[model samples]
Target: MFGWLFGRRKQEKFFLEMMKAAAEGEGRRKLFEAASMLGIIIKGAGTDEEKCAQIASGLVNNLLKASGTNINSNEDDQFVAALFSVIACSHFSRILTSQFELSAMLSWVILTAGDIEKIEISNQATEYYIDMTERKAPVLIAAGNSIAKWVNQPTAENFRAVVNVFDHCRSMVGYA
Candidate 1:
């Protein structure tokens, strides 16, 4: 669902695609397993405000946690891509805070199996993510970088590299 980024030009294109995919489509239990590895509690939105930063960091760092079924395999690409898409939506949900509908919690998340309703919920959340991207939200830049990290080796070193770029984006002081 995303690409490995190199220079600024490729980064822009990758961000565009990541944002588009969010406007589209889950493994909640598996996701929690990965999240907990980084000490993220997955409090869902509307929980304690103090937990927001933790969730945010978890959203970013979990890219390297490899929440998919088979790490370093082609099969895992979709899994990681889906996770990044959901995290992108979650970032917007956190930005929206309240009145955000079910956008934040991934609408019961993507981990449940064989339950048609949950699958629909997960798909709906994806649509939410996608629509937000259509709106061209600024979070797309950082969100794209998070997914782009995986397109490379998916190592912590690469994760840190993308995160440093993300940090640089955050540190910008002038108008875009």
Candidate 2:
């Protein structure tokens, strides 16, 4: 039956429950579920811009609290890192481009993780900054300045990656 396949009402209920769990801090299960939902939303077919922004905002707000407890705890760190990875992924970059809050959240995630040599997250954040610079150069330039502070200059790769992002942005503007 179509109902068996879709289970639309059940899906809705599940989503609502997940949202409640995210808000109530029902522990790692809820946090992980919320993070997974964000990944799905970012990677899902079609571009529902408004819906994506709303969901991303909610995820960012919920995870902010989760990040504060025991940064050195592997369990906590992994959960936060997974959520950060989801937010920083390429798919998420597109979903977040139109939303200032989501972009800011992505920047925050990168800055927060940079100290630990989180190259993947940093790369994604740089890519986002590049994309945003192309879309709204002035806004991203200002944002880039803030992101600049997070770079670990002692890490050659990280320094080069940041430079490359700026270079790429410059080249795009030159052609335009």
Best by TM-score: 1
132 Cα displacement, candidate 2 (Å): 26
Off-target runs (Cα >4 Å) in candidate 2 are 1-61, 64-70, 87-92, 97-113, 120-176
For residues 1-176, what per-residue lDDT tens digits would candidate 2 score against the true structure? 55787699987888899997665443323323444543523344443343343344344333333334332334334333333333333233442334544454444443354345444444454465556656876635542432232221223344344334433443443420
Instruction: State candidate 1's TM-score.
Output: 0.31
Tens digit per residue, CA lDDT, model 1, 1-176: 33453877888888888875553212323333434545667554544322333443355445334332222233233233333436544543433342233443432233332334445444553574577578876655565655344332344565566555444433342211
Worst 10-residue lDDT window, candidate 1: 67-76
* Stretches > 4 Å off in candidate 1: 1-26, 43-54, 57-87, 90-132, 135-142, 145-155, 174-176
Backbone clash count for every predicted candidate, in the order shown: 7, 0
Q: What is the lDDT of residue 151 in candidate 2?
A: 21
lDDT measured at residue 111 in model 2 versus the true structure, 0 to 100: 32
Reference-based lDDT, residue 135, model 1: 87
lDDT score for candidate 1 against the true structure: 0.43
